[model samples]
Target: RAASYEEQGVDEIVILDVSATLEGRRTQAETVRAVRARLSIPLTVGGGVREPDDAARLLDAGADKVAINTAAVDDPTRLDRLAERFGRQCVVVAIDAARRLDGEGWEVVTHAGKNRTGRDAILWARQAVERGAGEVLLTSFDQDGTREGYDLALLRAAASAVAVPVIASGGAATVAHLHEALGAGADAVLAASIFHDGDMTVGTVKRALARLGARVRA
Candidate 1:
């Protein structure tokens, strides 16, 4: 699947073991090594990044970046430490945010989205960036796997609050949805089922986004 996405002009790929944190297991860096041996585009691996050592192993195994979600919330200062230890460029802070009432804003979720931290998502984005996270992987739990659309309001708020790049995830049902996300200040957008089910092609999406004035790799 990683190789296929590359053939379709995907500039980068994110491979996450969603069960890592919940299961208390380490990231499968060996699998990353296998994929890295066959790919040219940058690869990001997340999950089970509990500390600086986990991030280090992923990098050593050939991952260009390591993403942290539950660990970041479990210890907010971990982001700072990871950035300082691994360099901010290699650390990505993944934030799973669920919409609050009326979709006015969002709150952070941890433990693979099963636990709410009661932390303001926007504020957390700012704090994460300040603590040395080079990028924010923002996922909307409310829209996750729903194929409805992205939470543009929440994305705008989070993106506006941080200077680092924001990678929007979840609820991308179509090419237009991805385009709208980039327009809403997201540095990049992550789609799953839409691509998995053949609803869209990466090359076509990139072309369309470029035509629509989005600064995507064409």
Candidate 2:
């Protein structure tokens, strides 16, 4: 699958063991190694990355970057340590945010969105960047798997709050959705179901975006 995405022109690939943290296990370094052996594109691996050693293992396994979520939330200083050890360019802060019930704003969620931290998403993004996260992977918990669309408001807020690049994720179902995300201030867009279920291809989506006047890699 990783090779297929590469052939289809995906700029980069992100492999997240979503259950690793929730199930109390580390991301499978062997799995990352296997995937890395097959592709030339950049890869980002995440899940159960509690410390610098975990990130080191992934990097040694060929991941271009390591993403941290639960661990960073548990200790913001973890971000500092990771950046210090691996360089900020190799660190990505993965934030799973859900809209507050009152609809006022978004809150950061950890443990695969099962635990709410009540931390304001925008503020957290800023702090993560300040603490040395090179990039932000922002996923909308409410919009994830809904195929409704990205939470543009959340994207806008996070992108505006941080100087580092923000990757918008979740609830993407169409090319227009990707374009909207970019317009909403996302540096990039991440989609799963649309590509996994064969509804779209990276090449096709890039073509559509190009037609819409959005610059895309050939």
Q: Which ten residues in a row have the lowest lDDT in candidate 1?
A: 99-108
Q: What is the alpha-carbon lDDT of model 1 when measured against the actual structure?
A: 0.90
TM-score on alpha carbons, each prediction: 0.96, 0.99
What is the alpha-carbon RMSD of candidate 2 to the true structure? 0.6
List the RMSD of every prediction in angstroms.
1.2, 0.6
Model 2: CA > 4 A from native: none
Candidate 2 weakest ten by summed lDDT: 109-118
lDDT of each: 0.90, 0.95
Candidate 2 residue-wise lDDT, 40-116, digit = tens: 99999999999999999999999999999999998999999999999999999999999998999999998777798
Q: Pick the candidate with the highest TM-score.
A: 2
